[model samples]
Target: MVVQTESFVMLSIVLFVLGAMGVLLRRNAIMVFMSIELMLNAANLALVAFARYWGNETGQLFVFFVITVAAAEVAVGLALIVAIFRSKRSINIDELHEMKG
Candidate 1:
């Protein structure tokens, strides 16, 4: 019932890469937001693994802060998405240029 640090780190890396790809390749705003969340979770996973290996609570504690910031980000991000969709009728990022003026 033991897990290897390398295994966890590798998993984290894979998840982060997948998230990054989604963000880079997708056009939908919601999809990109979910991808960002995925990346954050992957980072948190790695942090927890390292904290466990080091026999310390610091990583877990930092994860809590990350979670808090994520919550705030979600609130603000969703609000902005809604506002943009209301006016533009689409969540496509390419439409963002209209707001430049």
Candidate 2:
């Protein structure tokens, strides 16, 4: 039997939920950031799937832009994390309170 778009959407939803849970439950800053990225990727997958199903290019174009932004975010974020690690010697969110100032 052929798979349906609904099934794909459901899978994406599950992935998004898992990512959200991971972000909420993890204390490590890197793991939390990775979870957020996973959530973004899940949304991108759903958007592309929906675009294909509806015969529209806009959603796919939006996903491309989102991916570009995500890449930039990852680059900048990693740089910041590296700086923080050098100063703090740890990547735990709890130890990052000094970043507020």
Report the Cα lDDT for residue 55, model 1: 89
Highest TM-score: which candidate?
A: 1
Clashes of each: 0, 0
Clashing pairs in 2: none
Worst 10 residues of 1 by lDDT: 92-101
Candidate 1: lDDT of 97?
78
Residue 77 CA error for candidate 2 (Å)? 0.7
Model 2 weakest 10-residue run by lDDT: 92-101
Error of 2 at 46 (Å): 0.7
Task: Residues 38-76, candidate 1: write the lDDT tens digits.
Answer: 999999999999999998999999899999999999999
Candidates in order, TM-scores: namely 0.93, 0.89
* Per-residue lDDT of model 2, residues 52-83, tens digit only: 88998998998999999999999999998899
Which residue pairs in candidate 1 have backbone atoms (N, alpha carbon, C) closer than 3 angstroms, thus clashing?
none
CA lDDT scores, all candidates in order: 0.94, 0.89
Which sections of candidate 1 miss by over 4 Å? 99-101
TM-score, structure 2 vs. true: 0.89
Which segments of model 2 are wrong by more than 4 Å? 98-101
